[model samples]
Target: MKLHIVPARTGFQWVKLGAKTFFRQPLAMGGLFFMFMAAVSVLSLIPLLGTLISLALVPAATLGLMAASREAEQGRFPMPTLLVTAFRSGPANTRSILVLGAMYAAALMLVFGVGALLAPDVPAIEMPEGEVSPERVRAMFNNPGLWVALVLYVPVLMAFWHAPALVHWYGVSPFKSLFFSLMACWANKGAMLLYSLGWMAVIMMAGVVMNLLAVLLGGAALLNIVLYPMVLLLAAMFHTSIWFTVRDSFVTQEDRAA
Candidate 1:
């Protein structure tokens, strides 16, 4: 089959495809959730191990892409079995995905460290006789150097924005994956920015809701359990959307035409 790269689709279409693919495979989706829980559990036990295991997060993120690709390859999108076959076929692709993921993590950590260093010292919050002042909190937000660091790090952020999908869909080398992912972001800057912003909005809303629920429920653990699966689900969908975009934008039909 020839690999024809398509133009980036609308966010709604990408998200719809992701939801459809996820809901179609219960066991596979369950397995993906299990892997995420296992990673979280392991990380909670050992911080260093968690950092190492973090490399797999992108591969976990790409599970939907793997499932979708396998279904397409087999000429059948069977509901219950899609994820199983996807996992079987994912070893090589997952390795590539992890390689890109590790590179991205390293880059992000370096950027974040630099940002932290450049940021001004945060003042200690002193409670008044009764309540903390909002003005005091707002005053801490005034750091130009930190802002500069953030601006400089945008390229690194953009590089990783679609990396998992690039690896999963294209099975490209790490260098090529990084190159194409960033280039795709550059080519479709507006769409990519909107995608990033939308993801942030979802995450922020989820956080707010979960915090509120925690206050009402009296145990944040329940909130964590609920949010964990949802986070994994959203991560899976986001990576799948990127996979579709990369498959459409980077992998050429001619290259696979042979």
Candidate 2:
């Protein structure tokens, strides 16, 4: 049973690919999720450790992408242990994963840097020896720099949108992957832009609903519990979509034969 790369024509195609990919290797996918959660939780506890842990996430994620690509190519749906086994197999793949991860880290830093630059230089709120006014808080929200930051962050988000798939599955170097991924952004600009915007919109809407629920339910923790899995699932779907795109465009017949 040769794995065929299907053309993605609509949102349903992406969703189906995502769901099918997970269903084919539930145990492995589940294990990956658990490992990711455990790592995130542990990193969150240590001061400044979160940044270090964040660096690993891209590589780990790229590892998952590689695992999926290998499984798909072989037409075999192995269990979760396969992921661990694959990682232990060689140093070359590990290096590729780390390189891909570093690309993501660089993108994250760029995004943060842009945001920092665009953020307004507002003085810290001081207790003017009297009660604070609501108008002051409202004024903060209306800052032009804040709006610019929000607008500029969109492209940064889109830049590395398919990066994991590019490095993990395509076996491209970081520089090449970055080049092609950016080409992907421009070539499929409409679909890629819409995809990012659509996801962002969904996230924003979900955040609003969750925040409202949190206010009514008495805390955001419960909302987070529900949201975390949803976010992960979406992330998986996004990565899978990127895989489909890259596989169809860049992966050669010889590579698949190997």
Candidate 3:
């Protein structure tokens, strides 16, 4: 595959195309996403190593979702088996993807460790007598360590973003896949930025609409009832968009020859 530069407007196109494609087979697409989450959750139940294993499976999982998206884009119903596309590609591709996953997991853990060191310890806030305060919940997320971890995560994210596809489709080595992924991201930073912002806007609008619904429908109970399903839909749509990003960012040999 050859790298291709996309205009910033292509980012918005990705979002729209993703949503449109997802709607075309909402049940199948949404089911695949849910299945992926279920698989991850089940893996997370394993033991002390469960979390690490789940993290390591992330790149593969992402690739599987993108594969599903590819199917949906082509007007085919993506089967549940598509979820394992990465592992089924071939022994070499599977090995490369696993190596990429391990690298991602390690990089993330190291970043988290450094972030923890950089952030000051947060004292626990004890609430009175069986009370659940929003302030306390918000405080947990207001940690500097979390922000630091998030900031450090960007490059790790970049490195793995397209690495799985590169490995599966091109037989690229693990290290080279990471390099190409990073360079592609840097090269297409404008499109990537707009793509990210578009998703952010979509999510923010969802939240606003959800809040309005809660107000009209009468409470947090209704909000909670709607929130989980909405989250799954949004997540599915986001994964659907990822395939477009990869598609636009790279060209096949035939396209190059043309």
Judging by TM-score against the true structure, name the best candidate. 3
Ranked by lDDT, the better of candidates 1 and 2 is 1
- CA displacement after TM-score superposition, residue 184 of candidate 3 (Å): 0.5
Leading candidate by lDDT = 3
Model 3, position 159: C-alpha lDDT score: 87
Model 3: residue 180 alpha-carbon error in angstroms: 0.4
C-alpha root-mean-square deviation, each candidate: 5.9, 6.2, 2.1
Compose the digit string of candidate 2's lDDT tens values, residues 1-258. Answer: 122333334334443565567666655555565666666787778776587556657556545655664575356764455444325547865676576666666766666677677677777766665455676677668677666667766665455555555555556665676666666666665554455565566568777888888888868577767777767765654454445444544546786788
* Predicted structure 2, TM vs. truth: 0.63
Report the Cα lDDT for residue 84, model 2: 48
- Encode model 1's per-residue lDDT on 1-258: one tens digit a residue: 122333344544555555566566544555654565575677757767576566545444455545554463344543444333324455786566567667766776676678778777776777856454886657656765667678868887666665555555456676776676677778876555555666777778878888898888866677767886677767765544554445445545666664
lDDT for every model? 0.60, 0.59, 0.90
Residue 224, model 2: Cα distance from true site in angstroms: 6.9
| Steric overlap count per candidate | 1, 1, 0
Candidate 2 residue pairs in backbone clash = 28-80
Clash-forming residue pairs, model 1: 6-248
Ranking by lDDT: 3, 1, 2
